[model samples]
Target: MNKKKPITPFGWAIKQRLTELQMDQKSFCELHGIPPSRLSNLIHGTRKAARYRQLVAKLLDIHLTEEK
Candidate 1:
């Protein structure tokens, strides 16, 4: 069976915004003063997005609600 990687809604949104901005992960994190590991954790579902969602949303100019 082929399993798809898990991604949260916030992660999806952040990725979309990153693509829109033409920014890479390392540059984005560095420019925003966000630790790469933390962002990586959120993207890969290794950590709860709740911890970093707000900050990321603000940085990405996205509005995120707690519904998902």
Candidate 2:
């Protein structure tokens, strides 16, 4: 049986965009001036999405509604 690994929403979106851009997490973090550890925490769900919502939206080129 084939199994899929689970990922957090933030992790999936960032990973998808990075794959499309042929980029790596380290490079993306450096280019965006975001600390790698912060991204890592967000991806791993150690940090709440609300904590970095705006920055994450900016990185993904999407606008977040007020409720988010």
The numbered model that scores best in TM-score is 1
Worst 10 residues of 1 by lDDT: 2-11
- Per-residue accuracy of model 2 over 1-68 as CA lDDT, tens digit each: 74433466767677887888899989988898888887876666666657565686687775555422
| Whole-model alpha-carbon lDDT for candidate 1 | 0.79
State every prediction's TM-score relative to the real structure.
0.76, 0.69
lDDT at position 58, candidate 2: 80
Error of 2 at 57 (Å): 1.9
Candidate 2 ranges beyond 4 A from true positions:
1-6, 49-51, 62-68
- In model 2, pairs of residues that clash are none
Clash count, candidate 2? 0
Backbone clash pairs for candidate 1 read none
TM-score of 1: 0.76
lDDT of 1 by residue, 28-58 (tens): 9899888898887777667765656678878
Give the top-scoring candidate (lDDT): 1
Q: Give Cα-based local distance difference scores for all models.
A: 0.79, 0.71
